[model samples]
Target: MVRALSFCAASPPAAGPHRIGAGRSSEVFAEGPDRVVKLYRQPFEPEAVVNELAASRLAHGFGLPVPEAFGIVGRAGRTGILFVRLDGAPMTVRYAYNPLGLLPALRRVARIQHAIHACPAPGLPSQHARLRHQIEGARVPEPLRRAALAALDRLPVGDRLCHGDVHPGNVIATGAGLHLIDWQKASAGDPAADVARSELMLRYGRLGPAWFSRLFPVRMARRLIAAWYVASYRAASGLPNEAIAAWRLPVAVSRLFGRPSDTDAELLAAIAALARQRPDSESASLFSGPGRSPGRGQPECCR
Candidate 1:
């Protein structure tokens, strides 16, 4: 488990660490009343961190609601970023009981998505390409790797900034409107594919389907929210093995069945029926593949 850094009120802001949130590369902390800090513990692609910070600033510049930047706190070697802390309850907690509120909340999400999708993404494509590019180095079993590669090849030609993790947890209900947090996974890529991720996560995360279904239009629902979405969606190299598989059928099934979406049920039944024809060994093999990364795997459906 990760340790929380010590927070010393009397010490200088850089003299101590305060835990806020942890991701693969960095830990967020409160530097003071007005500033939050991100300290990178491990060697990270500095450009990636710069990209996220720049993306956040760009979003703010575009008149999109997001946290304000304070400046860099630590040096380039031991990285840390400072930003103006925003206040609000995470939409995740709010939606836990009052699922009905999701509709209004999702409208806010849709607006954010629309704004980011409309932004020009030239330097950002490499980050997304890393995500969409197939993993060919490992000794992946035959057919499954083929399927993943096929999925990679079929990805649509798209150019837009994608908030790769667009779940409710990343959104906050601040007074200025919804504020987006955690820009770590933001990238430039296909907009619909990003929408597909939101659909899958909402369904698989067991957040339910009512609000999600309301937001997606017919084209997004059919093209970006269905089987096509799963087939073409990218999986980053660092994604855990479980997260990779979950992105495919099982999670998609959970999304479909959990919401009790007619489209999802039909899609689930079709996938299951197809799976039944494969040899038992081959069927079991689907559960393991090159896509699995080494970390906490995502659940097919989370409570």
Candidate 2:
């Protein structure tokens, strides 16, 4: 494995390497006084990095609060990029303790969403086309896949920029302003679909419980939220053989059966009520019983 410190040190000693953090695909290294380097892992596409860099540029053109992309580096199968270091703490640590902070956080997220949706760009992919491709390739059950495709077909299509992933972790509340990072999955699409995806991510990841409560109190219809959750997962994580498939459908159904939302209240109550009336079905057991490893019959990404 190529280590961050070794690579950073070799590149330019004048800019000393400083330990930052690493994720599944890359490790961050302090490259300059105000910039960081993202060293990509093996098999991670250089095109993805280039695409994200282009997106960051596009975001900057729109005057959105996003990190400045310095440039990208590639050599001997290794790839990396330089970005302006956002000078702010992750909102996650702060929000966990003060749940009341979720409202403001969500409002900020919504405003960002509004900004992106207002952007005008051409040659963007259609939500229906993308969702259809995903469902066809996704490793979900045929029935569930069909259901998701049907739902996707009903969604409105528009020419708006979508962050694709807008959870709190990607947002940095800085002294200057809130900056968004990670643009590899961005595309132009409907704002509601984007908002729905964020809402689902927040609800399913248990990231915005407080904000959700504040936005849609106990009196709102919960069915709409459940529908939004399922639709978002179907659209975003429908990689045919991805590990996300194992949890996507189940999690979507969970939102319908577990929580109550103003948007999806009726649907949630109906699903949960039906579940309560019937005994647990053993149909899914075949996928879990003897001869099956934890990931057997599931996507390879799970293993």
Candidate 3:
């Protein structure tokens, strides 16, 4: 059964609130000293808001460090969620200045992700179902799409909580500790699948325009960060490389459904290449070897 929560009416118009952050689908506003409101853009789905609310409550009930979800609110003809604001810099911004902190930061992310998977998330949508939907809808070549669907079928189904999107940007480092935000994509499924999604985002997920990503230094830094993250997660989860790799195709397809950007071309090509290869092909070699890729001994970024 779907859990229901009431929506509170906003005191001030949505546009009047001081904006703190913005993402593809929503804009976060500082409602007060201890709370914030995330107002979705026009034409947003109410179902998504409901899912986030229930998922946030579930994570909090498990004693996770997620913010307390006060309730939903309507402001300026938009739906928003009221949450306790934890004032802290996103892990991404923190790492940008001190690249040397990359590995430990990723390790911390791994621990938090693992802890999320340890809790049961009943009443949440199924990750497999969501991925299957994405695979069916992805605008990839037909063969690759079908192959991804087949791969999804072969994977095991699980009830463990999966933070659909667990990237550094979504994690906040407060004085109390790290708090995982953005529960909109949370689901219940195989923990390996969730880890696989994170790996794809950290490694190949486009950060910005293709032109900016083409720079040698930027590309190298991203690769190093991604490689270290995968390594750290592998060590922490004790899950074999193959287990995570198996979910790559499906996860890649799902990523396509996100807001389109200039980097879509490269992402599509990568997905197509993986789809053509056999499940056990040498492509899995990407996850093997020290540091995952041939690079200088531990780049100063992840010191």
Candidate 4:
């Protein structure tokens, strides 16, 4: 069951901080000796920042390895978040430099994800509601969208905290330990749906524009990593394959709202087709053959 969280307002940080890093939506700046400020590039609702801060505090309270958030701050005409600074490279960069360590890295990733799901976080947005909104707003065929939404409505509602975007890039490996960041998308929901979302982002989500697809070696490495990652997660969580498989289509439909690259077009089409099929007959097969790994030979749904 979901637990209640305390939402405490935090004071804004001081101005003129040194920039440390930048992401698609926000810029990180060094605040004091222990904290950093994440200033958003565009205007966002205050409630979003409040929710993230609450989630961070909730996770930290559960003894999960997450950065501690101080609170929201407004600086330079943009809203920002002040939180503990983690000194480490993202898992993606680390794996890129040491491809051979992919298996071990995936093991750690799966353990951390399992840890996240082990904790209950109430008072956060419901992932089910969020996916429903995304499915309703996606620019896919009307029939596919409707089918996806219907599938989502039939799934069980869960209260576990899901790091909505649990990709390698969002995981930081420090000397102390691994830390999960980007709590902006964190929500309360079914753990299976959360796991399925990570699978989609790691395997099928585009890294950049269409031209990046030409990197065949990199793509193959990613596929290998994705397969191992999903396998590791399944083992660590001890959740049935069918539970995670059930979420694939709805998660894929929600991902369509991101405007994924053309490379994902065929995979998305396969996911839509599977979503329209009978749930019990072939949905599980979409991610695994009779004897193969969970994602090794599956269709785009597993990719």
lDDT of 2 by residue, 1-32 (tens): 10112212223233334646554467667766
Which tens-of-lDDT digit does each residue in 54-173 have in candidate 4? 888888888777888888888878898888887776676666657678678777877788788877878999899999989898878888898888889889889888888888767777
Largest lDDT belongs to which candidate?
A: 3
Residue ranges of candidate 4 with Cα displaced over 4 Å: 1-17, 214-218, 258-267, 281-284, 289-303
TM agreement with the true structure for every prediction: 0.59, 0.61, 0.87, 0.84
**Residue 202 in model 1: shift from native, Å?**
2.4
Off by over 4 Å in 1: 1-17, 23-25, 75-78, 134-141, 205-303
For candidate 3, the 10 contiguous residues with the lowest summed lDDT are: 1-10
Best by TM-score: 3
Q: Regarding lDDT, does 3 or 4 come out ahead?
A: 3
Cα lDDT for residue 72, candidate 2: 91
lDDT of 1 by residue, 110-167 (tens): 5566567667665664433554342342223344344434544555556666776666
Q: What value does the lDDT take at residue 22 in candidate 3?
A: 66
Cα deviation of 263, candidate 1, in Å: 22
Which candidate, 1 or 3, has the higher TM-score? 3
Give candidate 2's whole-model lDDT.
Answer: 0.52
Give me the displacement of residue 303 in model 4, in angstroms. 35
